[model samples]
Target: MRTVADALHDRHRDQLKRSQLQAHPLLTGCAPWVIRRVAAVADEVLFPPGELLAEQGRTPGWFLLIRSGVAEVARNGALLGVVGAGDHYGEVPLLGRGAHPATVRAITPVHAWVIGAQRFVPLVDDVRPIRETLAASLAAQPALVAAARAELASRIQSMRREGSNTWPGIRPPRRRRSVRVLHVLAAIAMFVAVAVGAAAMYHPPYAVIRPGPVVDVANDIEISGAAVHPIHGRYLLVMVHTERPTLLSFATAAILGHHRPVEHVTALGGQPDVERQLHGQFTKSQQDAALAAAAALGIRPSASGALPFTVRFRDRDVVGPSGGLVYALAIEDMLSGADHAHGRTVAATGAIDPAGDVIPVGFVDDKAIAAQRAGAQVLVSPTSEVYLAADSGVRVVGASSLREALDRLAASN
Candidate 1:
């Protein structure tokens, strides 16, 4: 009599063969389209002897239907039974009740139809018979599993004695040593993949500060409640980008020497919402920049309230007080009726107070690099951070306050 395997071999299409040979009770009386849907995502998996099909206490990721060979199912080291051709497993765990109660390991070379949980779970909900069959199987699992294991184990023994690799009707395929080599290579690849995945998911304790956009604040700022004048110079605001270090990025940066690492506490400032906090700081910096500009212009706030002049930085992505000095200079230059930049590009980075003091900010070196790359001829920074500027091919001018920075820029002119 021709076996399922022989019939499968006769078919030209592998999917048609799988559809017939790997038939489960769930597909019984189901529509042809339903069967075709399952077949679409089904994959044929081969397991070497001693390979685990599923582990106890672990959630099943695939539903397996045995097409050939035998596997031993065990719970806590005790063999519950054996499963062979036409036997199916993994429904219970996929149902979300609990993890696999038993471990299933291939005792002989195995070929099975495997459907991943991502695809299988939806079918259980959409297909009635599949859900019903799995539910029935789950309800009578204990007694049914015991009886099925005994019968399949005896049948497997008979097939083994007959020198067949599969069930009674199927002829065994010729075995080769290369199958073992393929299995070894697959195992090594899996281990390497897992190691790489784990490393990628692991977050390091540091971040990197890299050169970011160099924005010309002169043209980008919106000032109202004051007479706005046309500007001829660029006051660039230098920004530094920070990123959480990954294994690959860290290694690449180490080799490149293009970015510098900083401790998490320093980079994040211990804020869960660092971006939001920085944006807030930027908002305050704009206010301070406005006040500092007014102080430099000798425009004192009224006794009732500060000057009604409003300063709004256009680039919403800029999220720090590093542009405070630059913003102040832009406002002062625009309100002063003359361009301090003199049609030249000048970059500046520092925090500022309403009193016009230029407070040093971190990432000065990175900002200097950004300034140079943006073709800025001069970078005005806090006196304290001027030494931090590397050999960036740009002139660095140190200033302790807005008034001093203005004087320095004038002197440069």
Candidate 2:
């Protein structure tokens, strides 16, 4: 009853499915029945060269398994690295509530298999080999991998107790500890500090500077350009320019890896509405409100007579009221002779608190793209934002505080 063209299509689809089953490392150990189930749920996609496979920071619908050619991974516009045949991408967001870490672009004519999450979950559940392989793959990732290992371990333990000896030579369970007794004892000694001799290397605490006499001269300067250069100097200073107090403080604190004094100034306004519109896909009034809030901060009229500080501008309007902490820090680093003068631009994002703790910001991919456009070589971000940097192929150092950022910069230089 099938026409010739229809028959050919079915044959091609079957061939592709067979290739997928044979090539995937995880599928290798799957039973024949499980493989057939996965094949039925999988779809094949062909893309022209230069096509966008996926966008950064967005949820993906499929777990892409590359079959041929190559894909370039990027965050914003910065290149993260390349993925080739037999490699899998998009597993990060597929497993979590967070957005996709990077964008994938086709570097050549390509073919790939797309498996929906709903279907993939069942396949993983039906096959132990798939679960084990995925866990092992994610094991190197501290956040996700640790959880995966723990879950896998628990599952294995439960199976052992049930007398399902699927995995042979497994060790018996160890004796349990007294949870209640340990909790009480640990709480009593929580504040005790024992003095050990100074370590061979000790990182200094991060200090945030306010509008003191030394920094007042550099507060309103405009940055002509910014780029992350190679580590030719012994120290580096990263600056963020935005009107969001929360973002500025958080960015500075996160990058510096310790609490530091932040100088506050009303410099420029940001495109909060545009950002919200782009990120949340909001309606007109909501977008307008965000824009209005961003527009509240007016731009400085001229760069003339402004301090010689490197000014960071969020939304390019120069009217935001924040980013002073980052700008001040960069200027301080430059003035303090910490190096980075030879065209190295370091990029980062965070909201600055009044107390100077750097908070996390959104659209990390866009910020990374902006940094790359400005010719940055090294980018530092909060530990939470490292995934964006990794997917974009940017060399990123993760810091929890200003001091930690400085220490990383020093070490790299």
Which candidate number has the best TM-score? 1
Best by lDDT: 1
What are the per-residue Cα lDDT tens digits for candidate 1 across 136-160? 8877776544544444455557767
Which pairs in model 1 have colliding backbones? none
Q: Model 2: residues >4 Å from true position, as ranges?
A: 3-16, 143-413
Error of 1 at 200 (Å): 4.7
Error of 2 at 313 (Å): 51
List TM-score per model, in order: 0.50, 0.33
Residues 1-413 of candidate 2 have per-residue lDDT tens digits of 88999999989868657755665655666677767776888787776545777776555567877765456676656665666556786565555434566678764345677888778767667767766777666555556434334444555576688876456687789998777877877766663322111221222222232211111212333344333222232212233333223444545565775442222211121223323322231122122222221222221223352322234423322222223223433543533445532345555443333223333333344455555555556666655456765765657776544445555666765
Clash totals for all candidate models: 0, 48
What is the alpha-carbon lDDT for the whole of candidate 2?
0.49
The positional error of residue 138 in candidate 2, measured at the CA in angstroms, is: 2.0
Q: What is the C-alpha lDDT of each candidate?
A: 0.75, 0.49
